[model samples]
Target: MHHATPLINTIVGGLVLAFLLGILANRFRISPLVGYLVAGVLVGPHTPGFVADTSLAPELAELGVILLMFGVGLHFSLKDLMAVKSIAIPGAIAQIAVATLLGITFSTVMHWTLVNGLVFGLCLSTASTVVLLRALEERQLIDSRRGQIAIGWLIVEDLVMVLTLVLLPAYGKLLGGESETMRQVWLDLALTLGKVAAFITLMIVVGRRVVPWVLAKSASTGSRELFTLSVLAMALGIAFGAVELFGVSFALGAFFAGVVLNESELSHRAAHDTLPLRDAFAVLFFVSVGMLFDPLIVIHEPLAVLATLAIILVGKSAAAFALVKLFGHSRRTALTISVSLAQIGEFAFILAGLGISLGMLSPQGQNLVLAGAILSIMVNPLMFALLERYLARHDPGDEETTDRQPGEETQLPLEVCHHALLVGYGRVGSLIGARLAEAGMPMVVIENTRARVDMLRNQGINVVLGNAAKPEILSLARLDCARWLLLTIPNGFEAGEIVALAREKRPDLSIIVRAHYDDEVAYITERGATQVVMGEREIATSMIALLQLDAAKLPY
Candidate 1:
């Protein structure tokens, strides 16, 4: 008997291989993304063994794209984009043009048609939102000025891609010798644009009111499961509705759904709740992209792959760097933005897929884009590391001298000293913070979540929006001057690192950490935590005290 169906085998195999390779990559201090893509290649049809269900992967990948775009929409900020418009808009446009031209040149050299070249160029123009965000967040730069500009630039790229996705089918028809006449082509274009406009208008006007109302009602029910289900329903429902009614893509619909829901007070909760599912599906998406990449391309078309890499890593970076510098930013800022944008990921896959579907891009073109994406992602972290080392060696005070621009609030006061430093602002951390605030103690919080950072600031607390594990972020929290360091985040291994770093930085600081298990207590304590607080022990002690008090009151 067959032990597993295609769907089951694909998911289990894809996830299992991705997990193993992803761990291996992380162990080697490489991005898990490289491992995920490589996992796809290993299980791909082009591979020798354990080929996954080819038909099932793309369907799963579509869900990933929808959720990923929805997440983008949930976090999209019009105000933030407006703030960086001066540089982000022009820089992104110019950079896209430069990259597209380079891609066209490569396509021409490969003997592809102008239309194919155009589609390939367009695919190369956009950067991967997933990879870019992860890179920025890992380094604790998402709230920094450079991060803002990079994010804003990505938003513009996304908007352009959305438009391209909408118009591409019609444009492809026009170019594919399918349109009856130029008039018909223009008419088709008008209809597509009209439908997109109507969808956006309805979403902004109706969805803005209805989505929030629905979410508020779901919240009022006080059922976490119901709220989560409601958020998913909205995302999927809107996306389905858009395709059914407006001829918009699932990604575009999901993006608009997220943008509309982003206006709700519950947006952060929506994002938090959907994150796990989003990440899982996103992994599948990357794996699917990998499955499409034939490794033979590297051997069969080495120069094509080389040209693609040159365009992605060199040409694109150069364009972004020049544009940012031209916009009057510092060299450091230019480098930061350039390095951040030096890779492509999800959008490239989506655009390449669309181009293939339209019969404009050959399978070879898609493979080249995939190959380029993998190489660029692998090199991105190194690029950032090099930039950091360069800055440290040549301009030791560059990061310190870069002042916070207007509307940026992650900056901590240089004078803050002898205060308690709290990492994370989740449930346990919030309780501890409230107590500290009520006791009139000075405290600083280091959090990576933007929403939580806003909440903390609104309560008149000083906060740094970044991961505490990074030395730069730790520096921003004034760890050297901190009297106490509290680890309220639940991850034991991560807490150990933070404790070890804190102890190394300031040996006199009193460090308190919370853990869930016995081994975690030992692990954290050994790593220099002055006190390791265990939940089970604390609960047991409290219960024992209550029982004893009751017995004494009963005159036993």
Candidate 2:
């Protein structure tokens, strides 16, 4: 007896397939998003397989968008958002106009009406917030200047999409020859803008107070379940309320909710608790997006599909690249911003659906949008990889461009032999450096952060300024003569790469690396680390040692 379980089936099928393909994708050095989308395509109605409920998937994906935005908000403060506004605001608007114009041109070539082309252009203009955030988080760049600018730019795009969603219906009335007055159109636009303003103002003024209070009260109960539930309730409830009463998008609503909650002392705990749910739902979001893609669109309208994808990939990226350059940013910053905005996601789907409902977009147009989204998203990670390689090849010395004096060589002094090479100078690295300094030990620090590198230089310490993963940076540390290679970076994979490089350069060099997990320990050790200090294991060992001590005199 088979029970009717569409929701359960959808969730399980999506997750299992996503997991399997995700592993395969990672194995091949591809982004797991490609696998998730592939899984969706397999289970999608367009394919000959067990089709999952498409309607439920998007709703589940919406939760992903909400939670992802919420998590971003947790880390992004009001100050950070305001800091990037000068570049993000005008750059985003200009990029959107350029992409939209490109879209309109494509539509005209296809003999589409002006309204249809407008809808199509709009769909192609906005980048998916979820994709951009995920990319930043993966690279650990979410807090970087480039990441902040990308995020702020995305926020502006979201606002524009929200306005478009609200006004599309009124536009529909006019398209349908309903004699809708220009006054009504203006009224609708004003109402949407006013509501959005009110929501933002309310969240900033009232929410900043009430949200933290609620979390504090929940935390005081000492019930972890209650606390987690309170977080979810606030995220979901505020999002729903924003939609129902405030006419705001769920992504924006949940973002403000997280922003207010960020003021709470337990915001870190909140983020930690919801991380599993956030990741799982984010996978579902990608899977759901995949399910919408009809592969036949590619077969039937190859040129049109290619044209749409070119708009998303090339046209949008070039426009963004030029805008960032116009703002006097570096080639690296411009490339990063451009690549980040080269894909459209949830908002595009929403706008495409609305367009179809309003008769402004045909099914073919919607299919084209879906195709563009899937292809662009799948290739986005690869684009980033290329950017990394390009940067590595051309700008291996990240700080050497303008900061370094002409004819300066990044070599250790002839007197500084048998010195320890520290790969990071963050919190852990700084503590180790202090101890080394006190002992009067000679050491060289390899750090990527400009400020930290500058501070180290001012302290009269030998430091290499660039990513240690670069062979030149490693060579600058005099790895051949270094007594020890200390890998203190939190990123285990990156640490492993540096370890391997150092080992290949100096087989007898003692390599000590810090790890947060057993797998990291194993990976780094396998790459020739002499010792892997597992933080949790060390803490446990210390705790056990304390337990063995005499209880009466140990503490009161």
Q: Largest TM-score belongs to which candidate? A: 1
The whole-model lDDT of each prediction reads 0.82, 0.87
lDDT of 2 by residue, 420-519 (tens): 8998876689899999999999999987554566688899999976667766667767877989989988778778988898889889999999898888
Model 1 lDDT vs. the true structure? 0.82
Q: Residue-wise lDDT of candidate 1 within 192-226, one digit each (tens)?
A: 77888899899988998899899989989999999
Q: lDDT value for candidate 2?
A: 0.87
**Candidate 2: worst-modelled 10 consecutive residues by lDDT:** 399-408
lDDT score, residue 222, model 2? 92
User: CA RMSD for every model?
Assistant: 4.2, 6.2
Lowest-lDDT window of 10 residues in candidate 1?
398-407
lDDT (C-alpha) at residue 373 in model 2: 96
TM-score of 2: 0.78
